[model samples]
Target: MATANTLERIFSVDYKSKIQPIVSLCIGGWGLENLSEPNEVTIDNSTGNIYVADSGNNCVKVFDCDGKIMFKFGDKEGKGKMYRPIGLAICRDRILISQSRNCILNYQVNGEFVSSIGKLGKGELEFINPLGLTFDESNGEVYICDYNDNRIQILSQELTYKAQFGQDNLHSPLDVKLTKEYIYILDGSNPCFHLYDYNLILHKSVISREHKLQVFIPFFFFIDNSNNILIITDYYSIAFLNSQLELIHRIPITQPNGVTVDNRGRVIVVCDGGEHHLNIF
Candidate 1:
């Protein structure tokens, strides 16, 4: 709604303490060292464990809060194995993954395959290239960013199709997350971070030319406990926005594939292109 650039911005906020790179550790630092081409990352807020979608290794690696490998999955044979795991989410005791097929596969925290959601098609209970996904624990629903389908699909905790939105302005929706009062969609094609209500009504688009930050290309974003938006972009920077969608802090970092805020309000990122697989900031 309003445009403001870094140089011309009269006021700005700093989240330097949120991303402490000096005291951070890498993926292979704790002796596990098995991740390759990791994609999305999430933390188990209740337990402080981290989950990384090891796409290249075709598995998901779980690490304790101290960065020790607890366990891993995806080396199984038959249909239970993951071919190329990308997006991941954890709810209650279930771990949801988007990979291989056009569905979101459910599993136990211990790596047992539970069930699959949707199928490969264009119909209502179907998905074509499902990418990023998140679980709304408060509602027991799953919001999946159906990449090829260009929409966000809602599924009950039972994995049943309920409703969907975002077919109008999104082309390549890469990630989706739900806050207590809003839905944040990261659309790579639209090249903007869209903010919508729980009912899926378009409210505002952040960091665009209309909002002052031109050339901003959002890749992924996370809403922290305080409801502040942390957006990682192709511009090699993380743009911080307040709950009102106003740009505050723009912290620079290497290009990162995934980002999330831990229960302690610390930032966690996965740098797929760099030497480190995981970096805590």
Candidate 2:
């Protein structure tokens, strides 16, 4: 698909007003909140915080619920082997980081290092390019999206194996987010999404752009307070999906990666289009 930044001759529809679009809400009311090739974002309700995986910075930037950068963590220059860090999930009081280096570590709310949770290897509980992590708060289950292995592994809070879903068939599962009962996977290579129920049974493929199975690669996703609307972001656009997994409305953008919803239900999208775009509306 053509975008506003690439291949100038390509066509696009702004849908800025035809779809009753509203102006982009001024997040934090001001400041340069642009990002470089952002990868993931999550909203923490308890702390009223919004976290962004500033992958290019090799650090996670925590912002106030209103989009103000509160603090920055991790080394950004790819120093200390924090190169291309992925996966971030907030447990009760700490954050879990799946470093591309050798292990996933936890940190306190003050950005103090806690402890390493798992190692990186080919064996059990050993991760090779682990990319995403989520806490199944309902069951205290820890789910990991191991990209290199093309599998989503389920483990206990103690990091013990419970089950593994999607092995050879998964095409680079990128990020995962779970609710009380369902697990969502973003398969980038195949450019589709998958959902599994609590029993680990495949509920169905959620997002696609291919014919008869057309779905887009969802880099990240967030559910509203009601769990009725889903904000799915990929490299090129942000799409809003209904609870049934139907794309109710899709907004075209540049290289979008990080996404989240504000208190007012406004969508905050960080896009990397050379201009460092953060399109919110």
Candidate 3:
């Protein structure tokens, strides 16, 4: 492969052990009655609570660290009405959801309606199909993936627009993660992910196929405690990469869609292709 300036190529990656699922979740009603289409999964850093955006069911399911179904919100009724909710992120005491609206809805830890962040527009403090999002807990900042707008917007903890980036190579971006050192964006385009600095400078685009892997469809990923990037691809596997963008390990999974890491660095994946259930390793 040619040595590109932004996206470099690697030939081989270390294949680590395939961690088995410690717990599998299938919590809901029954017989196509619950968890119709779960789009994303997130973990509460403070409490290790698992939040699943049950889109088809028009609700958000909360699970404890042990995979026990705690409670659910957003039943299309009151303040927690979730219309096709797709994304989820938990920072501190707040739960952020990106659903049918162009804005991001917020709720307290107890599932009480709190406030919203952006609106439906093309400008700052405005969003178009806002999808995955993450929080910079250290600096009280939120990084959101404005999917249709092809940009990533940064906002203060108070939901004030700070800055935005990725107008050049962000085509259908899905998830946005903010680590201690860099901003990881999963675009699902040619260059699957674009890693940038805090200032939104173009650092490098991490393409999954560069390593000659079978990652045809890259969905969601999260950074572990060791800063390793765990990516869930469409080919029933998880690719692990180091902070330097080098592939380190590949774990086998079963048609995983959304993935996150718990407080204990366990891999939590939501599989919809097979059983439409959630699994934790």
Off by over 4 Å in 2: 1-34, 75-81, 210-214, 225-227
Residues 136-254 of candidate 1: C-alpha lDDT, one tens digit per residue: 87767888898898899988868888998888878889888766556788888757778788767998776465665443666666666344444554447667766656677666776
lDDT tens digits, residue span 1-281, model 2: 10100111223323232233243322321233545555666666467677766666666767775566688776433223355556677766777777777567666655666566557665677778888777766556777888887788887766677788788567788777765456677788867778777777787774476533334556666655254556677556667766676666767776666676554555667665666554556
Candidate 3, 1-281: lDDT as tens digits = 11101101212322255467778766434333356678788877667788888877777888888877788877456545678888887767888898877878889877788776667888998989888887776666778889889999888878888998998879978887765566788887664778797667988876767754335677777765344444554547777766665666676766677787655656778877646778877
How many pairs collide in each candidate, listed in order?
A: 4, 7, 1
Each prediction's TM-score versus the true structure: 0.85, 0.77, 0.85
TM-score (C-alpha, index-matched) for candidate 1? 0.85
TM-score of 2: 0.77
Clashing pairs in 2: 208-214, 208-215, 208-216, 209-214, 209-215, 210-214, 210-215
Candidate numbers sorted by lDDT from highest down = 3, 1, 2
Where is model 2 poorest over a 10-residue stretch in terms of lDDT? 1-10
